[model samples]
Target chain A: MAATYVSYFGFVIKSVRGMFTGGPRYYAWLSFLVLLMAAGAAAYYRQAVLGLGVTGMTDQVSWGLYIANFTFLVGVAAAAVMMVIPGYLYHDKAVKGGVLLGEMVAIGAILMCLLFVMADLGRPDRMWHMIPPFGKFNFPVSMLAWDVLVLNGYLLLNLHVPGYLLYKRYRGEEPAKWLYLPFVYISIVWAISIHTVTAFLYTGLAGRPFWNAAILAPRFIASAFCAGPAFIVLVLEIVRGWTRFPMGDRLITFLRQVVLIAGLINIFLLISEIFTEFYAASAHVASARYLFFGLHGHDALVPWIWTSISLNVLALLALVSRRFEQRGLVVRNLPLAMLIVAIWIEKGMGLVFPGFIPTPLGEIVEYLPSANEVVVSAGIWGLGLFVMTVLIKHAVDIETGAVAKNN
Target chain B: MSGGSRIRPGDVKRRGFLKLLTALTAGAVTAPADAEAFDLDAFLQKHFHQMSDDEKRRTLQRLEQDYNDKYERDDFTVVADGPTPGVKFAYALNLSKCIGCRRCVHACVQENNQHRGREERGDQVEYIRVLEMEKGSLDLEKAVHDYDHEVPAEDKYYMPVQCHHCNAAPCVKACPVEATWQEPDGIVVVDYNWCIGCRYCAAACPYWARKFNWIEPRLPADEINPDTHYLGNRPRYKGVMEKCTFCINRVRKGLNPACHDICPTGSRKFGNLLDKDSVIRRIIDHKRIYILKEEVGTDPSFYYFFD
Candidate 1:
């Protein structure tokens, strides 16, 4: 038993070393990522020195880019379950290979989600205030606390299951089904939970009439289901480009269907929400009005939201049409990429920022991310991509390189 | 190699040494002043309900001392005083009496030690927002928060809004760390030191009563209110959430908040809700008063009434 623990410890170190020892192209990519991270860190340091005042956030718009990114990443993190459910629960073979990669994407995305949260804090040093045994967390009451718990819990489950599977494969041992299968099922439910809790973080707020809707969680799920799988498809295409791994065309085909169905549902949900907003023309319609057309001569968001919807509709068409995919990878990937970007903007600023427009008392204050905020956001994305690169490299190594590992 | 035990001291020591290095480096950045300033006891202070009277007093004293040292002010004290027995605090505002002079806004800032230099920075922070609304139209969506040309304009009515100190405060319920909560006397106060500054409270407030310190709040040394309440206004750091505590410092001493006292027309009335004889009590008993968004079931103690 002691030997087993020692062997496991050794295996983890070896896996890390193996990950670092890659081709020159791999090292160059890492260096580029490191450079971006350094730039972001510098920008964040300035923000820390000057205070959050450096960001475009006023008391009028208390949350900005950091939270927008955090919200999107939570959905991205939750999107892993789209593959985990069909691959494990229903025992689908076509998606089985993609599930590990999906989980890997989740692992990277959740870490980014957490980093974005830390970047958003005014007193990052006081983060210990949320930890147990001291900080009196208002659980079951404060949706923020629920968010903190579920995000961390979801990250843990993803990390554990992926780490367990990879380590077992590396050691040339068949992973015991009992040891990790229960956890895989747990991850499926937990993935839904993390995004739901994130949605609740917005919906439960009584102040923001824009997010105070019953459809928010459903909207979050539908968008996430589409956005998450869309993101994975993009990653899979990139990975297949870089390696000779036997990725079937059927996998991409399967995922585009998921994206099409989910994306249409998302658009449908959005239209329903818009109808409710404009139908009665209640006081709450103030935010929706600001987002869609213009409100009170302050229509800065008008062009951006319409442009977002157009891209979404365009991508939905391209995703569903066989003629579009027949245009080839570069051509097809454009719409897929647009679908991802469309969802990113829609789920992000389009959702979070409008809630503050024509402030609760009816004053119109606009928000745009300051240069420092942009730099910091870029830094977090660079870090997530860097992590994704390493995780994908390791998985590909297991599939195509020295390890003759199998499930 | 060791045949019996794989565990090794040198490996453990190397790991320990690296961890120590990281801690020292992190400590240097986070705690630049005396290690004593980041009081472990204060940093790890337990929940208010879990603390004894002595513990509470100690915590307050440590904070008072920390502030005094940081600000170079020797005569600053933070009181931990609670409400008078059986006292339930409430407020009433007479719309007919308010003149829209904005003296109450400035007075509240002075009393509460809100960001004094915000105006100089092309910014402003105030607990009380006075709105100029067009007469006979209650569409809050069209009200203007910043109306410069007004001694209560001919066609306009003024309604100054602040924390209602509701029985069920959304801000209090929104704090993930429980850093903000309602006191027994119906005052919602923030433990600024413990707030993680997520601004969840600010978002949760329907009235937009809470304010975030975008910059480290500037209360000039000369302008600093020596008499401070721990929950009301001590100097705040950048990022923590703060709101009107109904001028809790003065109210605890049977005094009116600065805003109440400064109102020239005597529009604001505040006192114990349980006291049948208090002015606020009489206003509530006889006047046709309305609280904002009562359908939300927040049950605010503050009331607005017309003549």
Candidate 2:
């Protein structure tokens, strides 16, 4: 038992050492991420010193860019389940080889989600008050509490599965099924829960009519499946190009089918939501009005929502056409990139911002991300990418046998 | 392994990277001196309801001292008095009598030590919002809170809204840390120190009564209300949520809320709702009363009445 523990520690050390040994291009990419992260840290310092007031948030529109990014990234994290189910349940050999990379994306995305939540907090230092036993965890009651549990649990599950598998691979030994398979199955279900709970965080609010729809959870899951796999498709392509990981084109093709179906379902859910809000046009539709069009000349989000809608339609058409398959790699990947941005806008600012417009008192307060907020958000994204880049690099090296236990 | 060959520029680069990392971390850790200092006791302070009597007393004293130090005033006092026995507080406003002078808004600020800075600075926090609506319509969608005209336009009626202190307050249920809850006296109070500032409660409130301190609240020393309740109008920090506690400190001591006291037309009324003959109870029983957003089912203790 002690020998096993020591071996695991040695594996971690060697893997970390491998991450720092890449070429000049790798170093340049890492340096660029570091620069963005440093800028973000500086901007966040100003926000922390002054307050959230440094952002464009007001008492009327309390939440802004931080929460918007957090909401969108929760879906991104949950999308890892698309890979897990196919690799573990269906035993797809192509996907099975790349499951660790998918889980790495989950790790990176979850880390970003957590950072966004912290940035949104007014008393982040007092976060310990939410911990069980020490702080009053309003579990089973507050959806936010449920969100914390699910997000953290999902993070741990993603970490353990990949970590265990990578360690076993390093030893050139077969992984014991009992140690990691159960967690894989749990994660498949756990992935769905994180997004559902995040949806509940918004849906449970009775006062925000814009988010009170029963369709929210379904919409959240559908969008996660759509955007999650699309993002992984892009990452897998990068891995194939940058490393000798031998990822098959068949896996990318299979994921494109998943993205297509999930994207269709997402579009359907959105249409259903739009119809429900606009057909009858109740007073509760003020937020929807503010989002899709302008509310009393406050049209800040109108252009954004329309742009998102147009992109979704364009991407859906591109996915359906299959003409891109004959074209170059960039053209084939264009629809997926378009879908990602569309969903980002739809779920991020498109969903969170409008909920606060036409404040509960029937006042309209428009919110825009200040320069500081944008920098902080970009910094977090840079950090997530940096983490994922290192993690994937290490995992790929292990798979390629560049670093071995015997050596 | 040719260690000597590899150690030259690589070591220098690694050292440079480490130095950069260390500088970034140090920059992140070192907050401005005037920003809220890291207080160990304050950081580790227990939840307001969970603290024992002695703990509560110490916490209150610490808060008072912190406030005094921040404002450079020695007279700041914080009280942790609990709910008075057998008293269920409620409020009523005579809608017909209200003239929308906005005196209650300013008075609440003075009495509560609300931020008095410009709105652009995000420190301008006000508890009461007076809405001017068309006389014949109750549709809140058209109600204007920023009407700049003179008192009570002929075609408009005024409705002033603040924290309703609901019997089934959604904000309390929405609080992830249980930072806000309904007290024994039926007042929904927030433990400002315990709040995580996620603003979920503010979103859950249909009345839009809850407010967030986006920036460090700025109250001039001369304008600071020295007497404060721990769960009430104790000066708040930047990034916490606070709202009208129906003036928890004043009401528990048998004084009316500043909003109720400053109403120029005697439009606001407050009393112990548990009492059979209190003015609030009489108004609820005898007058035509309305609860804002009744469909939301908050079951507010606050009511609007017409004589």
> For candidate 1, what is the lDDT?
0.81
- Mark the 10 consecutive residues where model 1 chain A has the least summed lDDT: A398-407
Candidate 1 lDDT over residue span B177-279, tens digit each: 8888889898999887788888888888888898887765656677778788888877787767889998999999989989999999999999999988999
Q: Which candidate gets the maximum TM-score versus the true structure?
A: 2
Model 1 regions lying over 4 Å from their true place: A404-407, B1-42, B118-122
Give per-residue CA lDDT, model 1, range A1-407, as digits (tens): 99988887776666677678778998999999987787688667766755676677777777889999999989989998988888888887878877888989998999999999999998887887787776677888999888889888888898888788877777777899998899998888899999999999989877788998999999999999888898999999988887766688877888888888999999999999999999999888999899888886778778888888999999888776767786766898888788778888887668989988867888888887766678789889999989998888787777565543232
State the displacement of the C-alpha of residue A53, model 1, in Å, after optimal TM-score superposition.
1.1
How many backbone clashes can be found in candidate 2?
0
lDDT of 2 by residue, B1-307 (tens): 1110010111011124345346445673444344687778888988987889989888888888999998889998899778889999999999999999989998999999987755433235778888899989988789886777788899889999999999888898888899999999999999988999989998889999998877666677888889999989889987899999999889888999999998889999999988998998889889999888988888998999998
Worst 10 residues of 1 chain B by lDDT: B3-12
lDDT of 1 at B70: 74
lDDT, residue A190, candidate 2: 94
Which residue window of length 10 is worst by lDDT in model 2 chain A? A46-55
Q: Which residue pairs does candidate 2 place in steric collision?
A: none
Model 2 DockQ class: acceptable
